[model samples]
Target chain A: MREVFQQSLRDVQDRLVLIAELVEQAITEATTAFGSSDVGIAEKVIDRVEEIEILAAELDQLTIDILARQQPVASDLRLMVGALRMSASLERMADLAQHIAQLARYRYPESAIPAGLTKTFARMGALDVEMARKIVDLLRTQDPRLIAEVRDLDDDLDELHAKVFEKVLSDNLAETPANVVDSTLASRYHERFGDHAVGIARQIQYFISGSLD
Target chain B: MREVFQQSLRDVQDRLVLIAELVEQAITEATTAFGSSDVGIAEKVIDRVEEIEILAAELDQLTIDILARQQPVASDLRLMVGALRMSASLERMADLAQHIAQLARYRYPESAIPAGLTKTFARMGALDVEMARKIVDLLRTQDPRLIAEVRDLDDDLDELHAKVFEKVLSDNLAETPANVVDSTLASRYHERFGDHAVGIARQIQYFISGSLD
Candidate 1:
């Protein structure tokens, strides 16, 4: 029974990695959809939303099962808890991707983003993808130092976001109301994407450091 | 040894409640400062920032110790994890109070919030305080239902904040540039506080359900 439960734990970890991969793919697809204005790609990303949710539910059930069946202790307990947290973070990341897709859909027909603002949004998306990739690596290695590095990287994303805001408010004073609001909300979506990415890093940190903060 | 570990876990839970109490007090002081334009009370909250930080650090250490020594499993493991998350949420709540205090200090003497916006800000603070209180109760009792209710309550806050923005953009057009900017930022801060409060609930939900959705 113990051997079987241990094998199941390993399987759940594999599922977690797969979920993380799917989440990263969704991020890439959604961002690509927005940057390239491909509604078709965006739709594909949105369709994966249910799959991500289902996998996340399964991950949760797996953790509960491991806890009840094997009563994991020491490193095994940490791994199960870590897997659960990583699953949650990945799910949130996927949701953010879906949100971006919806935003892309909203901007279909006519791209409302100003050139300066679009560059900022693009940078934001790149940072998000970068963050997500780093988090997955950290999970794979359980490297505490890598988890620590994420905050500084998040600072860069934040700085870029602030610069984007300044440029939008200053350079687009005379733009249409619709254009201004769309750009502002788009910037907000990008910022939130950064936030969710940071959240993933924090979850990884909790797994290693045993505290979220 | 098992009994000692169990007692330590209980101690950690007790400390979490204490931290929540401090957070509640800080929010009350900060909100009162905002509502009354009391610079003195705001100054006091700023001074208490370190206290919140220290309490958070102490709680973190306690959580790590429990995890390390007790090596808890099942429900016991969840309790420790919950304690860690609750501390994090409380720390952030205290920081939000400090942020509000800073805002109050910036707009000192001449209260920038116009009389018309008073009701909106007041309502925002009220909801925040209520949510903070609810989280504390949930932590105290290990109640599961409040976890879901926090999300529902947060929706009301979001609606209230939107109404605030609509009111400002529509009715406060004649206001001075400084006041307009300040009010906008103030409203944003309030909205963010609501977001953080909802976050505490999310942590509680994970504690109750052992899942993050």
Candidate 2:
């Protein structure tokens, strides 16, 4: 019985990694759509969000099933709870990625980001994709170093987002109000991507350190 | 043991209600600060968010404990999971309220909603408060009608948010860039409050109906 229970738990973990991979794909493609203003890629990213949501629901049901079957205590309990929390954060990250794709699609034939800041957004997108990929490994390995790297990358994303905000608010004064709004919203979407990743890391920290703070 | 497990579950529900009340107060105080441009009220709302966070964590820990000890299945399991999801949504709702308060603080001596759209924001605030109150009732009764009411309120918030966005984009063209940014961000914050509430209601609906969608 114990072996069977552990097997189910292993299944849950593998499914979680799968969800993270799907989220990474969403982020990469969404940002690709955003940077290039490619409606085709954006549509593909948007379609992928449904798959992420479906997987999230499936993982959720599996976690509940394992908890009922094992009635795990202490560390095992924490792992299950953490899985539920991380699933939520990953789901939100995918939704944010979809938001980025929608912005690209919304302004099709015209990039949501101005040309002057395109390079900045491109940098942000790369950092975001890297963050998503690292999180997949973090889930599989539970490495503290990976969490630290994600945090550092998040700080960089914040800095870049602020730069985008400053440029759009003042330096890009000649831009249309609609375009400015798009830039602001898109930058926010990217910033939230990092924020949700950091949130998932915190949940992992809670699992390891048992600190609620 | 069964009675004890049921008691713990009830405690979880009661604590969830308390968090909802705190969120309600935060939204009211935050909007009051926005409307009056009163930094004092805004600061109070910001401080209250910590209490909300603490309560949210407590609810999470308690839910995990109950699940581990009880191994609740079927409807009981759904109820516990729903509480977890609702607690998260409430915490986020409080954070959104804090964001509104921060905007008010950032633009000290100047109303965050702007004079032209003050009435629109004022209406949003009223609807937000009402929604929070309705959620409390919904949790207590699990009434489907209350869920419908919450959805209706969210629609109202979306409509008001759109008006604010339209006004800032065109009619309020003479406003300073910073003011326009603040208005856009604040309205988005309020809209998110409704979004989160609607999300919680959906979880409740799922709990009642066992529907994944």
Candidate 3:
């Protein structure tokens, strides 16, 4: 029975890694689409949202089945709980990616990044993609070091998020209200993407260290 | 064993209702602070964030304890899963309220609601509070009717969300970039609050009906 439970856990971990890989792809394409205003790439990201959702639902079902059949406890039980949460965070990361892609799609002819703020947004996007990659690595390898790495990347993303607002509010930007609205939402989406990455990382930390902190 | 499990489930239900009540108060005060620029009320809302967080953490622990001890299955197991999800949504609702209140406090002497947006934000705030109240009622009574009601309120909130963007984008508003940013974020926060409420309602629906849809 213990060995069977371990196998179920391995299955859960494998699914989580697969979902993180998809999230990485989604954000990578999303950033590219947003940076260059590529509608075709944006559509591709949007198309995968349902796929991620379905996979997450399946994962939830699998975890619940494990709980029912194996009735895991202690660390094993925590692993199941962590799986459910990590799946939710990864699914949210996918949605944020889709939101970023939609921003690009909406402003097809016009760039989503306003003048003077393009470079800031590009850095933020790169940080998000990097964090997504680290998440995939952390899930695959369970490397505790990658957890802090993801959090440090989030700190940088937060700074860029603040910079976006600062530049937008400054009189020098000369952007339209539509530009302000789009930039605000877009910056927020990118920041939230980073946050969900941090959340997944923290969950992994909890699973490893056996502490909720 | 059955009776003890039922008691544990009731305890979980009661804690969820308690958290939901706190969330209702948080949004109510937050909206008031936002509309009137009451720093004191905003501060009150902000201070309650940790309280809600602690309560949610306690509830999660209790549910896990129940799961480990009782080993519930079938509908009982679904209820446990639903409880975890509902706790998360409720905690998120409280955070959104704190964010709204922070917006009010940030602008302090200046109102968070811009000149022409006062009425629209008021309506949105009222809808959010109403939805929060309905969530409490639904959790307490387990009446499926309240689920549909909460969803209908979300639809209205969604339209107002779009209208805020429409007015912000229109030439007639003539607002500052700061105003556009705050209003955009405020509207998004309100819309997300409603979305969380709908999420809780659906989880309850899933618990009662045995379907995830």
Model 3 segments more than 4 A misplaced: none
Stretches of candidate 2 above 4 Å error? A209-213
CAPRI quality band, candidate 2: medium
Estimate, for each residue in A61-176, the C-alpha lDDT of model 1 and write its tens digit: 77766765676666666666566656766787788788778767777865656665677778778877777777677657767776667777788878886675476557444444
**CA lDDT, every model vs. true structure:** 0.72, 0.86, 0.93
Candidate closest to the true structure, highest DockQ: 3
- List DockQ for all candidates: 0.16, 0.57, 0.88
Candidates ranked, most accurate by lDDT first: 3, 2, 1
Lowest summed lDDT across 10 adjacent residues in model 3 chain B is found at: B204-213
- Cα lDDT tens digits, model 3, B26-117, are 99999999999999999999999999999999999999988898999888988998899999999999999999999999988987677989
Candidate 3 residue-wise lDDT, A1-213, digit = tens: 999998998899999999999999999999999999999999999999899999999999999999998898888888898899999999999999999999999989899888888888889999999999999999999899999899999999999999998999999998999889989999999999999999999998988887756
Docking class of 1: incorrect
Residue A32 lDDT, candidate 3, scale 0-100: 94
Model 1 has a DockQ score of: 0.16
